[model samples]
Every structure is written in structure tokens, then in C-alpha cells.
Target: MLRPFLMFASLAFFAFSAPVQTPPPSGAPAAAPAPAVPADAAQTPNPVKPTAESQARAKQIYGYDCALCHGEKGDGKGDVAADMKTPMGDFTSSATLKSMTDGELYYVILKGKGQMPPEEGRAKPAEIWNLVIYLRSMSKQ
Candidate 1:
């Protein structure tokens, strides 16, 4: 009985003791920065940050294009929100916005998440930037 138990323990130990495989050693410097992704491939796309004039232009465009779903106050409770299956995001939450990069925001706006549809045709580039700025501004409050 002891002999059988010892054999089983040895087999178990061997089974658990397989050498861990290490990843390939980093012999060379890291690769260069990747190129930006194009608008066509990604569901949500981030555009480069806009200039002041463009930002202001973005605001107007946002009011015209985005206010329906995002709300006039950026609170995610726009009038049309009732029509959506997914509720709009609550922009006032710093915790939620801080983790997301500008690019991530762009992607969400360009590519609708869950119930939201992509804004690609609904908004021009400038309009999207305004929404980004609005989201960024939400961080302060």
C-alpha cells in the first residue's frame, strides 16, 4: 500500500514539475511606434486632437449632431436617449472618463458601442472633436 501511494505521489510531483517555458529573450531594442489606425477598420476611431478653432467648431457641430443622444449638457440623457436600447454614457463621472484615452473616446464615437450606432456618417470630423473636448472637460467636475 505504501509503495503504491509513493508511486502515485512521484507521478503527481513529476506531472506538476514540468519546466516552465520562458518567453523569448529581449535581445534588441523595442520596435518603433506603430502607425495610426485608419478610420475604416476600427469600430471606434480617435482623431488627432483639434486646434482651438476646430474645437469651437466641434462644439457647434456637436450641438447639431450629438446633442440628441449625448444631451445638451453632456449628461448622456439626451431626448433621443429614450429611443436607444443602451443608455448613453454619464459624462460627469471622472472615474469612467479618466481611464479612457482620447483615442478610445474617438473610437466609441465613431463606432457605436452595444446599442449605439456608429456616428461616422452622422457627424463630420469637427463635430466629433467637440464631443471629445466635452468629455475631457467633464474630468474637471
Candidate 2:
């Protein structure tokens, strides 16, 4: 009789001690916004001129680094673009290029924007300027 009573007490204690799971809140905080680019950084001009040699170098670099996501033709329809969470910029559109200045492009390339990774450490400043020229060519197409 005592053994049965002890077993019953143990079961009752375990049942009461079981953790209670509460439903999560309906609303959760949104993710933090991306950092804003400074006026000077956005206004900084590209010192490199668009020469054939520079453009060729830029093309090579872009093919190796940017073409995977920016597309081989710079149309923003790259192979991996569909799988990316962020929206890719359409470089082939004149309207899009017209709105953004060289400085803004430089800043974006250096610091990265939205889901784009920064090319600061990976690419030199001259190479980045060349890339800016290559991007300009994309708009003309």
C-alpha cells in the first residue's frame, strides 16, 4: 500500500513540475535598418578616366568578382541573383544609371548596399574606379 502511495505521489509531483510552454507574441521587432551613406562619401567623384586599358582590366575583375551576381552582361540577371534575398540593381537601364552619381556608385561598391557585399578589401581603389566606368558602359547598352 505504501509503495503504491509513494509512486502516485512521485507521478503527481512530476506532472505538476512539468514546464508550461507559452505561445510566442504575435508581433516581433523588425530588423535594424541599413546604415546611411555620408554626403561626402556619396559625392566623392571617380578620378579614374574611362580608357580602353582600364575598361579591359575592369571587365576582367568584374568577370571574376561581380559577374556571378551582376550578370555577365551587367543586366542584373546573374545566375545566383534568383537565389539571393536582396534585389539586384538593373545596370543596363539608363534611367537607373542616370539617377545615381559616380560617387554614389563608388560608395556603394566600397561599403556595400543592402545585400551586396563590400569590395573594399577585395578590390583596390583604382580597380573600383575602373568598375564604375564599366558600369557606365552597361547603361549605354
CA RMSD, predictions in order = 13.9, 7.8
Candidate 1 global lDDT:
0.68
The best candidate by lDDT is 2
Top candidate when judged by TM-score against the true structure: 2
C-alpha lDDT of residue 37 in model 2: 70
lDDT of 2 by residue, 20-94 (tens): 966535333332445577888778888987888889999999898888888898888788776653367788887
lDDT of 1 by residue, 25-94 (tens): 5443333343344554444445556677877777676677777887886778898785643376677777
Alpha-carbon TM-score of each model against the true structure:
0.53, 0.72
How accurate locally is residue 140 in candidate 2, as Cα lDDT from 0 to 100? 81
